[model samples]
Target: MDPTDAFFTQTVVGAPFTVLLGRRRQPGGSQAEGLHINLATGESRLSQLWQEWALLSHATPPGTARTRPGRVRRLMERHALWVAVLGLLSLTGSAVSWGLLLWK
Candidate 1:
C-alpha cells in the first residue's frame, strides 16, 4: 500500500469508524480535507452537506451570501455575542425610560 494510505487508514482495532478533518493540497491549492468516521463505506454526510451548500451559495447572486466560508463561519461564531449585546442595550434603554417616567 502507498505511504499516504497509512495516514488515511486506522491504526487501532476497535472502533468501526474514524474521522479526520484538516487542510490538504488539492490540484490547484490547499483545501479542506476530511476522512469521515466511516472509511469502509467511503462517504461523509457532513462533506455532502457542505458540498451542497457550496453549490447552492455559488448559484446565488453576488453579495447575497458570504464571500468566503471562513469569514461566514467567523460571523456565525460572533452572531450570538452581537445579539446578546444588542439585547442588553435594549433592556438598559427600556429601564432608563421607565426610570424617567417614575421621576416625572
Candidate 2:
C-alpha cells in the first residue's frame, strides 16, 4: 500500500511511540481509525518494508522493478549457498592435508 495513501504526515495522539494513523469511514458515516503503523519502535522492520516498497514502486521506463535487491533480501537469498560452499571447502582442505600427512 502507498504510505501516503494509508497514512498522512500527522501523528496519532497519545501513543508511546511515534505512530501514524489513517482514518476510514464507517457504515454509520463516522470516521474510524483504519491503520496504525508503529513507525519509531519498529523502525528496523519498517525499514526493510520501505526498501522493498521502493524497489517495487520505483520503475524504469522499461517497467522493471529494480536492478538490485535490498541488502536483507540479498543475504536472505544467498545465506545457505555461501555457508554450504565454505563447509565443503573446509572439508576438502582437511582431507587433502590428511592425505599428505599419511603419505609422509
Candidate 3:
C-alpha cells in the first residue's frame, strides 16, 4: 500500500460471563467469541487521520510551512540506526578512559 493510501478496520467482540467463588469449572456451558471487522476510513486519508485528529483545521494546502526537525531527530532519521549503537560504544570508551585515569 502507498504511504498516502490508508486502510482501517475496527473489530468488536465480547463475551459476557460471571464468576463465583470456589468455582471448579465454568458456571456457564460455553460462550462463542463473535467478532467483526469494519472499515472506518472516510473519503480520504487526510479526512480520517489529519482533519479528524485536529492536526489542522482543514486539509493541508500546497506549500504549507512545516517546522524542520531538530538536529537530534534529523540524525536519528538519517544514516543512523534507531538503537543508537554509537551511543553505547561511546559510553564504553568513556568508562575505559576513566579506568585508565584511576589506574595511573
- Winning candidate number (TM-score): 3
Candidate 1 residue lDDT tens string, 1-104? 68566555645443234332222224553345433456897665556535555567537564575456697777877797887898999999999999999999
Alpha-carbon RMSD, each predicted model: 15.2, 14.2, 20.6
Candidate 3 or 2, higher TM-score: 3
* Decoy 3 TM-score against native: 0.28
Model 3, span 14-98: residue lDDT tens: 3434532212236663542222234674332332332343554465564888778899888778957645788888999999999
- Candidate 1 clashing pairs, residues 3+ apart or interchain: none
TM-score of each: 0.27, 0.27, 0.28
Backbone collision count in every prediction? 0, 0, 0
Residue 65's lDDT within candidate 1 is 59
Root-mean-square deviation of candidate 3: 20.6
Model 2: CA > 4 A from native: 1-78
**Between 1 and 3, whose TM-score is larger?**
3
Give lDDT for model 2. Answer: 0.58
Q: What are the per-residue Cα lDDT tens digits for candidate 2 across 38-59?
A: 6877533344434554576544
Compare the candidates by lDDT and give the number of the best one.
1
Find the 10 residues in a row with the least total lDDT in model 3. Answer: 5-14
